[model samples]
Target: MMLSGVVSAFEKVLIPVAGRISSNRYLLAMRDSFSTILPFMIVGSFFGIIEWVVIDPTGTVMGPNGMGLGMKMTGLTGEAYLASAFVATLKSLQALCNLVVTIGFGVLSLFLVAAFSYRLGGIWGGDKFSTALTGIGAFLIVTPQQVNKVGGFSLDYFGNKGVLAALLVATVSSWVFVKLTKNKKIRIHMPDTVPPAVAQSFAVLVPVLFTLGGFALFAALLTWFDIPPLNDLIYKVIQAPLMGFSQGMGFSLLYQFIIWLFWWFGIHGHNVTAAIQNTVYMPAQLANQDGTASYIFSNGFFEAGLMHIMGLVIAVFLFSKKESWRAVAKLGAPAMLFNIQEPLAFGLPIVLNPILLVPYILAPLANTFVGWLAVSSGLVPIFRFVVPWTMPLFFCGTIGTGSIMGGLLQVVWLAMDVFIYAPFVIAANRIDDEINEE
Candidate 1:
């Protein structure tokens, strides 16, 4: 009864807070914007694995001895015509892969600006096209055009470094556009006979122009003061620090705890936390992909390493004396293999169930610590690929890290998690028996 009271109190406070955070317009815009580019990011990382790790003779997989697949198969060494041609072919393929990655991950912030404004426009009832253009213009206006002797709009502000600035510019630009269009006095009302497409374009023109011009003036002021571009400033002052803190074990542990805590109260913890996770950890994932930095924890870590629900299913199936628990495990086992735990979460009644709460939360945290240790100790490579949430257990880790050691690490974590849940399942059987006798 006391446990139930405590659960009710926590639920009262947390459900409302999580709901508000999850439903916030700006955060939704940020989440959807990042989501819009996720497929492209995955495509880039897939080819990046091929370009940097799979084929290159100097890569970790191929070794520094120049004995690549083609060389080994053809029984040829340096300077031979066939070997030289193969090497040239490999280089060409690498260049092509690099092109794909460049167009995708290379201009991530550019996509974010357009996507964020488009989503925000929908939320604000603005014309999506015009609002997106204004957002992009605002971003470009506040971004540096020259970098490292590159004259045209620099690539420096188009990648992960410009992510936060892109979101900021998109929000401000979309707000201005929405507000201006709503003002009847300033709106360019077209004739009733005019086509809707043409009329809509003309109607949004003033809003787009003024919003972009405002950013242009802001950019000019920064230049006059000899200040760095807004992208650089935000990266230095905000994004970098947040990214650093997110990579720490303390932050990962707290985040894991909060996620399960929300889950225990029947909230979709992952969706509720998506906004902050995408905003902070995603940049570190990009940096790791680019090999500019090493961050052991990333968005991929959750899907690949820390989702230990399958472990509980196994423990229940193998060790639980309770028939109800085994039945839920049987039904939930297949879905859990694919990393979906909703069936078990509700069926096993993980929500508000005092017996299961400790293991439900503790398993993921334990997996996180072990996963972090494995990656940091160089036993498993840092996660670079963004594995789909539906990716199966062992393969998720392997594909995410682009190494077999990652799969082994997942197995290790799974075994540990199973043990964690086993004892709890036995305890639950005892409690059930006691209730029956009473």
Candidate 2:
């Protein structure tokens, strides 16, 4: 009788504390932004680069073999040393591949910035490598007004160098923002109604206006004045704020649009996710020149895999509320075994929940940081192995990072999710209780 009384006393304390922790509004906001906005921005930028810089140059040619096929199929043979069909094809292929890889590197750098900013609460001081690259890229892209010209030799034309100058400028801008706002919390005020017309307007107008304005200003400055490096400065200052604003606005609007579409179709956004994965994400893996096979696990296994685990665990604990726990159990059981969570996401209504959002976002960002640290510190091998996306989290981590340490880190993420969500579940139960009472 004494032991039963003690257990009851503990439960009373535990429930309320869990409820309070789960109700943290700031954490919920952060999670919502990270989940709904960050992923889309990253993916959209990637696709933009691919469309603008990559596919424009290469058409359907994937690699050297594709180029060779074009040459052979055209039935054009010439002097091997001269501008032969093979040589032209090779040159085109090389140029295309280089452009793709370089743009990919730039996109990856941007992603790092975005990830770091989110992790650091929407602020990131530039790192040395990223900053320097951004500077060089910006200087090249933004042409300054030429001064003291001997004859007509001005370095104010847009070229490959301009792209580098733009990058550099972006880096510096990010660094400056970080330094200025490090101590302050960023206030994000999202509007309630995001109408389709408004969303579409912003989506088209924002990027176009900013990008064009940046280039035009740089060109005007170069033509009117004799400033040599003015273009670089202009580029740097413009890139960060423009990129951030455009990306943030576009992603939020796009997400809402997608949600609406899903509702109309009576389907979840999983189909969209699958299409993106199959096309954009998977094709990127094939960019590696090495003979190693490319796979879905290459890009997303660690992040998505752990989410599945966390979702399942949370679903298990929250089961008593709706008797949805049994459904969660049934679906989550197979998914958790294979490290997939589409069922949980759709079934559990975790997409827009204020409570679960925190863990959903924080867990992945935290895991990514940990994984990066481990790889950088040589605690784990750089993942070179290719595994299918369908692989379980533990095995995915092991193969993706090429170390058992990655798997261990995944476990840490799973633990974090439990801690993060347990309180949420408890809070949700309390709310349910209040509703029942009412």
Candidate 3:
């Protein structure tokens, strides 16, 4: 539904504008599609940064001494500080804001590091150029201890600007490479009739090659400079994005795999919720609370927990045309409770449904806003307590946010979810009924 609206709006608004610039229908269409995708990429990149840089720095971006600043900031307060309502309120809000900012920063940082590394690799042609590999490396190496040390040494020569020096070197090197290669275009020849497997392989290989080339170029640049070892820079650049992408993809795949596993055993896949909670969710909770580890797990549960479950399931249930209501029932029970529901998703047959894809992406984003509000308003506690993900929804809220009021806010979230999804459900059910009659 959300996606439909976006598409509709884009056709009405963007298409006309694009048509004026390009007389060719194909070019106009491509331009419009690109324009539509740009916003999502930007927004995704922003949230990704938050998750990596701010929320889960320990796990995502931080080095050994990264928490020093946070510790120093919090150390200024004592137990007595918690006693003051004003201070408590401020601290709570600060923590929440910090988490959001960190996650956003982390995601953006990943993109920056990747983009820079790609450019760097292209300049030097140093090693196997793989963007994914180099990006993973950069993420690992940019930790606080390493960054501070590099920055500190650089500062000794360049004043407080040594860190800036590194950033500058990275930026300039990347810009030059992009300028050289940006205009080059390649065309692949595929038979008009191709086997499915061959087509799929080709599809996968294109991106893989691009990534490798990007990484190799970054490696080459490092070797040329002899400033930072190509291997070290590449390693750090690659780690965070690689981990984040893999973790997210792995959890998603695991959820679906568990659903199938349960169905084969004639048991509902709902129990997989507990597994997710124990594994990914619980670790996220622990990391958020760990004194030196807080940044790494910031809002981990919210993104990995509440949003993931709700976003995909809700989108499918609302837009599907098969067993819509039944699917909703299957999903809503565990979703409302444990927040897991892949069985419901498969039943809905929503995987490729165009109309439903919109909300699948947007609804979780809407939930993010709600979570942010709860934190900012002090209605929910900022992340403080480390609890299991399978903990009841209310408890998860209370402990994750660190306030009783936060627990109470979960009720509001429940209400919001129902409200947002109900219309879509009704629409889906009507569609399903019509299809059945046909």
Candidate 4:
């Protein structure tokens, strides 16, 4: 009874709060901005896997301590394979893959600025394409230029390190552009006889100029005071500290707990946390890929490591006596293999089920801790690739961490989760049996 009352009180507070967060326009724009670049990131990751696994001379398949797939396939000794023209051809292929990766995810902040500004501008009733262009202009205005080389722009601020600055610039510049465009006094008037494209272009011109100019002025002022570029300043002052805090085990546990807590109340916890995930964990994952940092906990860790639901599904089938439980398990089994938990989460009715809540929450928390420990202790490789959240277990781990040990680790985590859920499944069956007898 106490548990029930406590749950009710928490639900009254949490649901409304979570709903507002999930619906907030700025957060929504940020979330969608990340979503917009996900395809490109995935494509980059796919090519990156190929580069590391199949082509790169210094990578898993061909490196000094690698599996020697190249040596074996070429019918040559390890030293001979390294010297052969075939290795040169492989290097060329690797270069091509790197080229794609360099453009796709290496300059993600640029895409983030455009996507965020486009989405937010549309919401604020501005010309989206022009506003997006203006956002990019603002970003470039504040980004440091190369002083030693003519017509040269440094790409230092085009990557994940510049993400916070990108979003901030996008928000402020997009709002300014929209507000100016909406004002009759600011935007130039064009006759209806003009082609729609021409008229629209003219209408956004003044707003775009002002938006970009304001950022240019800000950058000039920073330079006059000998301050670092805005991107570097924001990263050092705000993003770096937040990222460090997010890397702590305590934060990881709280993050995992809140996800399950929201799930327990039938809220889409992942959606509620989407903005935070994009802003914090996504950059960490990119940093890991770029070799700039070694963060063990990241978006990839959640997707490829802790998102398993198959253990609970297996437990239900093995221990549940209730027909409804078995039926949901059978229906959810296929989806659970791909890490889609909704069928089991809602269909098995894990939501609000006191008996199942312990295991449902505990399973993921255990996985998060174990995964973190494994990576931090060097028992498993840190995740580097952006494996799709729906990618099947074992495979995601293997590809994401670039090691077979990663797949083996998932097997271990799966067994642990099954053990955690089994007793609870049996207890729920017993309760149902008693209820039926009554």
Predicted model with the maximum TM-score: 4
TM-score of each: 0.66, 0.36, 0.36, 0.70
Candidate 2 residues lying further than 4 Å off, grouped into runs, are 1-315, 318-322
* Best-first order by TM-score: 4, 1, 3, 2
Q: How far is 38's C-alpha from truth in model 3 (Å)?
A: 29
| Candidate 1 runs further than 4 Å off | 1-13, 60-68, 78-83, 147-150, 239-364, 371-410, 417-438
The lDDT leader among the candidates is 4
Cα RMSDs, all models? 7.0, 16.1, 17.2, 6.5
Can you write out model 2's per-residue Cα lDDT over 4-113, one digit (the tens) per residue?
A: 34334544764565456446543342233234333443344344434432333222232222243433554543343224555465555555654544443333333333
Taking the tens digit of each residue's C-alpha lDDT, what string does model 4 give over 1-438? 444454446557756775676677776676667667767766775677687665777566676556767776777776687789878889999899988877776787888899999999988888899989999999888889888857667776787666768878999999999999998897787888999999998888888888888998999999999998897676556555566679898888888889787676555466445545766888889998899988898888887755456888888878878889899889988767756566677788876666666777888889988998898899999888776565678887887788988888899899998898887777776656666889
State how far residue 318 of model 2 sits from its true place (Å).
7.4
lDDT of each: 0.76, 0.44, 0.43, 0.78
Off by over 4 Å in 3: 1-297, 304-341, 386-392, 435-438
What digit string (tens of lDDT, one per residue) describes model 3 on residues 1-438? 453454455446644544454454322322232233234343443443444333442321221223433334444334433344544544555466555444333233343344445545544442213432444443333332225533521112121112222333344434333333333343243586998667544433444455445655665676577746532343345444444532353444444455433332223233223324333444555665664443322334353235343534444455544555455655565643544343444445333333343444444545556665655565555566654334456666665565666667665665566556655555555644556789
- Rank list by lDDT: 4, 1, 2, 3
Of 1 and 4, the candidate ahead on TM-score is 4
Query: For model 1, how big is the CA root-mean-square deviation?
Result: 7.0
